[model samples]
Target: EKSSHLSAALLGEDCEISPEQLYELLQYAALGKHHNAAQPSWCHIYHQSRLAGVVVIVLHEMSQLHFYKFYLQFKHLRKVFRHRFTLPPPSANFLASLCGEGSGLNPQGTAPGLISTGAECIPKSSGLQCDPIIRKYGKEKRGLTSYTLTSEELRKNDYPMRDSPGCKGYMYTECDLQRTDSSPLFGLDCEMCLTARGNEVVRVSLVDAEGQCLLNELVKPESVIVNYCTRYSGVTRKMLLPVKTRLPDIQTRLKKILPHDAVLVGHSLNADLQALQMIHPSVIDTSLLFARNEGRRFKLKFLAKAVLGKEIQCKQRLGHDPAEDARAALELAQFFIKKGPVKILQRALKDVPLSTFSIIQFSLDPEYVASHRLVGFCEKVRNKLTDMLTIYAGPFEEDFCLKSVKKEFGKCGPIQSLTVVTETYQPYVCIQYGVLEAAQLAVESLNGAEVAGSCVKVQRPITAATLDCDVLIKELELDIENEGVIYVAGIKKSLTETDLQEEFSPLKDLETLFLPKDLQSGKHSTCCFLKFQKSQSAADALEAINGWAVKGSTLRSRHALASGHLWRWIWQMNHSSEKQGGNSLSEKMAPLSDSITASHLGTSLNRDILHKKELSAAVSSIATPQQLVMVPAAGGSVVLLHDNTFIISQGEKTGSDVLSAAQDGTKHHIFYQKKKYTDSTASGGFLMLFKGK
Candidate 1:
C-alpha cells in the first residue's frame, strides 16, 4: 500500500472503484436517468442476470457534465435496490485503471498516464474535435456516416464534378444519391494516351470491395492518336488495333456494371473520371484521405508500400497494372475505415521518412475539410450571382463590324450572339457568351481595350431585374430542347417572317422559324431565330450561311442563348396590358381609331407592322354608332372624349390636353370641307374640322 510508484494524492478523499464499477458507471451514463419506469429500462440488456450486449449512446455537451456509478441488485426477487456509491472529487483523479499498460489507447488519450474519465469529453488542443468557429457557415452538419469526398476535396483534385443535371455530354452516377458509409465500395483506375483532344482513356479497370475484378476493358479514343504514352500508359498502337470500345460504350458498360449505391474509391480518382468523361456522385479520393504536407498527395505507389506493407508498381514492369493498383486502393480504404485515423497515423509515423507527423495530422481535423467546403461553396455562389454573361461594349468612334468584335471577344470563349443597337444616339454592342467564365475573362482582359482607335468600356448592363439573367440565359442555351435553335443576328431589316421561313425552310430538316419583335416598338428587330428538326441541321446551317451575304448585309449565326428572356418580356407585356383592362397583344390588338391619320400613314411606315392587320380587324368590329369622323390636321388628329377632354395624336404618338372646354357650356359641331380634299390623297374620308360655339 505504501509503494513509491503510487502517489499519496490518489489515496486521498477521492474513492476509486473496481473495473466492474467502472463498466457499470459507463452503462448508467449511457442509459441516462429515465424517471417513472416500472422496471429498469436497461433490464432488457441483461438476460438471466448476465450482460449479453450493450446499446451505444452518443452524448453532446453544452456544459460540464459528470457521471457517477452505483450497483443495482434485485432483492427477494420482487424489487431492485441501489447499493452504496461514491462520486469522485471535483478535480481530475485516476478513478480506476480502465486500460492496461499495453492498451495502446494512451497515445491518443487526453491524459497520457491516467485513466480517461469524463474529463476526456472536454475538448483538448491535441484531441480530435469538431471545430465550432465555422459550424454556422456549413450547409449541412457533418455526419460520421458520410464517406464521400467533400466539396473542397473534389475541387482541389479537379474532378469533373456536377451538382445539377443538364450539363451536356456528362452522365450522373445516381439520380438520387445515398450518402452513407453503408454503400458498396468499388475501386477504379484508368490509363490514358495522348490524343488530339488531350488525355483519353486507353484502358480502365474496376474492382469490388472484396478485390474481385468487375470490369477491365481497352478503349479507343475519338480523336486521332497523337502519342501512345507507352512509358506510363503501356498502350501502343499494336495492342489497341483490335479494340473497338469507345468512351460512350465504356460509359454505358460502367453504368450497367455499377449499382446505384456504389461508392468509387481511387487515388487521384478525378483524373480517371476526366479521362473517361464521366461524373460520379459519390467518391472517396485516397489522396485526400491520406493527406500529405500542404495539400500534396503522396504517390499511389508510395502509399501502397508504406501503408499496406506491400510493394506495388515495381520498376521492372513496363507500367502499372490497373487491376492490381485498383485492388491496392480498395484495401487502403478498407484499412482506414477498420483501424480509424489515429491508429493508422500512429502506424504510418514509424515507416514515414519525413521528420514530422504534420502531413497526416492535419487531415484529422474535420474543421479543415469543412472550411475548404465552405470556400468552394462560396465560390460557386459568387459565380451564380455574377451578371457578366452579357457585356455592353461600345460608343465606338466609327461603326464597328461584326468581324472585328468577333475577333476580339472570341479569344476569350465562344460567343453566342452579338447584337448591334444602332437606333440609339450612341451605338453599342451586346456580347453574349455560352458560359460565365468566358464573360468574366472578357471583362477582366478586354474591358478597357482600344477598338477602332477608341477605348470602349465593357461591363454588365446597368439594369436590374427580378431574376438572374445570366443563369437563365446559360441554362436555356444548354438545354437539350433548344439544341437545334440558332439565333441569327444582324439580319437585313427588310426581310419579313415569311421571307425568312421561305429562305430556311427549303434546307433539310427545317421545322419552324420565329422572328422576335420589340416589345415597345411593336416591330421586328434585325434578328431572326429559327429551329431545325435536328441539331446537325443547325450546325450545317451555321456552316453554310453564317457569313453569306444577302440583301446587302451579312448574316451572323450562333446557337440561341437568350430566347427565354424575350419570351418572358413578351409575357410580362401581355400580362401588364390585361391588368390595365386593355386587350392584350396576344388576345386582340389595341385599336388605332384615335390615331389613324394621314401623318401616321407616311411617317410611321414600319411602326406597328406586326399589329396592322389586328388593328384593322379590331376597328372593323366597332359598332357604327361609336365611330367618329375627324379631319387629319397637318400635324396630328384631334379626338373629343366623353368627359369633354381633348387629345391630340401625331403619327404613332398621342397626348391629352387639360383644357376644360366643358366649363364654358358650349356646344361643338363638326363640318366637312369636301373641296379642300379634292386634290389630296385622303379620298375615302372627307376633311372635317371641329369648332366650339
Candidate 2:
C-alpha cells in the first residue's frame, strides 16, 4: 500500500505497481542502483500476517531525503517511515518556499495549500547514515510482500568474513539464520528410513512462533523400509507398524499450515527437502548458516552448541528428536540475528578504525599465516567500508584440494590456509586470509575459474566462516623453522622408508623423516614428510625427486611447513621410556629382532629421533646391520625420520654386545635387524618407522 500510495501520488490514479516495480524502486531507495532490480533488493513489503518491525530503508545519501524535508510533501511517504521522518514540522516559510507561494509566482497564480513537515531534517554527506529511531520501529504493516534484493557481491555469505549489502539497520537475507519477525516462519526437521529406492521421510517435527508444535507426524513411506536406521532416526518397526499418516496426507496438512511464501528453517535443509521431496526457495539452512564452505555443512548440533549455547540431537536413547533438531536450527538462526552479523561485520572490516571493526587474531594457523601473509598485510580491504569476503572456493574434482586452492588463489594474493570442504558431489576449499587484498583478488579471479573438472565457486566463507578468534589465529601462526621440510605425496604402498632414504640420497643433508603408516592394515601412507638438515637441501631434494615414479606410481612433492610442536614431539618421544606404563609408546612400535648386529660406524634412533639409550636400543633391534648408515650427530643423536639402507661395505660387522661395547669408539657404525615400516604410537597417533643411531 505504501508503494501503491506513493506510486499513485507520483504517477496517477490506477498507476499501481506490480510486485516487480515496487521491488526495483525499493532497491533504488535502500541499496544504490544495481542490476537485477527485482530479484535482489532491500525494500520489502510484508503481508498482513507479518508483524511490522524496523526495516532499514536506504536512500541515496546525496538525494534530497538527506537534507530537505521533501518526504513530508507526501503523507504516504510519512507512513512509510513509520510517521517518524527526521524532518521537523515545516515553518510557513519552508512550505511557502516549496510551492513558490512566498518567494515567487505560483503556476496557478494563487497561494499553495498548506503542507506539514514530519520531523527535523538532518543533512548528510557522502556515506549512509541511518535513522536509528525509525529503524528501531520498522514499518509495521501487512499484505503483498516484496523487498529489493541486493546484488550477490554486496552480500557477505562468508564465515567470520561474511559480506553484507550496505544498510545499517538490521537486515535479513535468505538463509541468513536471522530471526523472523512473525511472517509465518516455521522450523522443520525430518527423520528418514532406508527403503529399496533410498531414503524416505518417516517422521517430521515442525515448530512455529512461540515454540508451538505446528505439525508433528510419522509418515508412512510408499514402500516397506529396508532399515529402520534407528541409530540416528529414532523411528522403530513397532511405531510404524500401526497405521501411520500417509506422505501425501501429511503434505496436505503441511501445505495448509504453511504459507506458500513462508520462510522455512532447518539444518542441511537440502537433505530434509529431498527426503520430503519438497521444493522451497525461501529456506534458511543452518548448515549453510554455519557452513564451512559452499557445499560444506556443519551439523545442526554443532551450531546449536556453539552459537545458541544449547545441545540438540545428542540423546539417542529416545531416538533423534526432530523437534529438538528443528528448534535448535531455529534458535541458531535467531542467535545470528541477535549477534552473528555484528561480530562478522567487525571482523570483516578489521582495517577500519572502528571498535565495531576489531578482530583478535592471536591464534591463526602457521601455514595459513605464511600462505596469506596475514602478518604483514592489512587484515581486510573492501571496495567500500563494508564488503565481506569469502576466502574459500569449491565443487572441485579429485585433482583439486588444499594445494589447488592455494595455487590458484596465490596468483591473486596471499592466503592463510585452504581446506577442502568435503561433500559428496562437490568438495570446496575453505580458506582464511591474512590480508584483504589477496582475498579480494582471489574472489574476483578464481570464483568461477575451472578447478580440475569442476567450475569452482569462490567467495567469502559462508558455511565455512569462522569467528573463533583463537581457533583461526592459532591456525594462522606458522611453524617458523619448518622450512627444511618437504612434502612427499602419492607414496607407493609397496615403498618402504628405506626406499625413500635411497631416493632422497641426491640431497645429502639429512634430517628426521615423517612417514606414518596404517598399523592395523600395515599400509604405507601415500604422503610423508622428509625434513632435511638444511632448508636449502629440502628445496633441492624437492626439485630432484618431485614426480619421481617408483612402484608403478609417480610421487608428488612440495615444500612442507615445519610443525609448531617440534619441541613437544621431541619431549614425548624422549620421555616415552621413563614414563612407567604397561603399554608405552616403545611397545606400540614393534620391538627389534633379538639377535642383532652392528658395525662400529652405525647407531640407533626411534620414531621421534634423537632419543636416549633405551629408545636407541629399541630402534637398533629393528634394523639389519647393513641398514645402518651413520650421519654426524652432536653428542647424543638427532632424529632421522628416513629409514637407512646401505649395502655392507664387505666389512666385518659386530653383534649387539660388541657394538654396544664399541659404541664409545665408533666413527661410523652399522646396525642389523628387520621390522615392517607400518607402525603406530601407543596413544593411537601414527608415526613412521626409520633407522637412526
Candidate achieving the largest lDDT? 1
Off by over 4 Å in 1: 1-144, 163-167, 175-177, 353-693
* lDDT, candidate 2, 1-693, per-residue tens: 432111111111112233333323433222222211232232333331121211233322122222212222343453333212122223445333332244343424311211111111101112112222113223332221221112331133321112323222322222333323545557899999899889998999899855788888888899868988887889888888895588777766776777645777777665776566554445565565442212334455544554555756665366788888888877766655444333422332111111010111123335554724531221221111012223667776433333344555554423334444433444465665433333554565567878655687876644322343223323222232344666565566577889877866666686666665433455555556676767678777878775577676665565543232321222233254345332322232222231221211122222223223433443444534324334422112222232432221111222233335443443333332233112231122212233544
Supply candidate 1's per-residue lDDT for 293: 34
**Candidate 2: deviation at residue 283, Å?**
1.7
lDDT of 1 at 629: 52
Which regions of candidate 2 fall more than 4 Å away from where they truly are?
1-182, 291-297, 338-340, 343-508, 513-693
What would the TM-scores of all predictions be?
0.32, 0.30
C-alpha positional error of residue 558 in candidate 2 after TM-score superposition, expressed in Å: 20
lDDT of 2: 0.44
Which 10 residues in a row give candidate 1 its minimum summed lDDT?
62-71
Clashing pairs in 1: none
Least lDDT summed over 10 consecutive residues: which range in candidate 2?
A: 352-361
Kindly state the number of residue pairs that clash in model 2.
Answer: 81
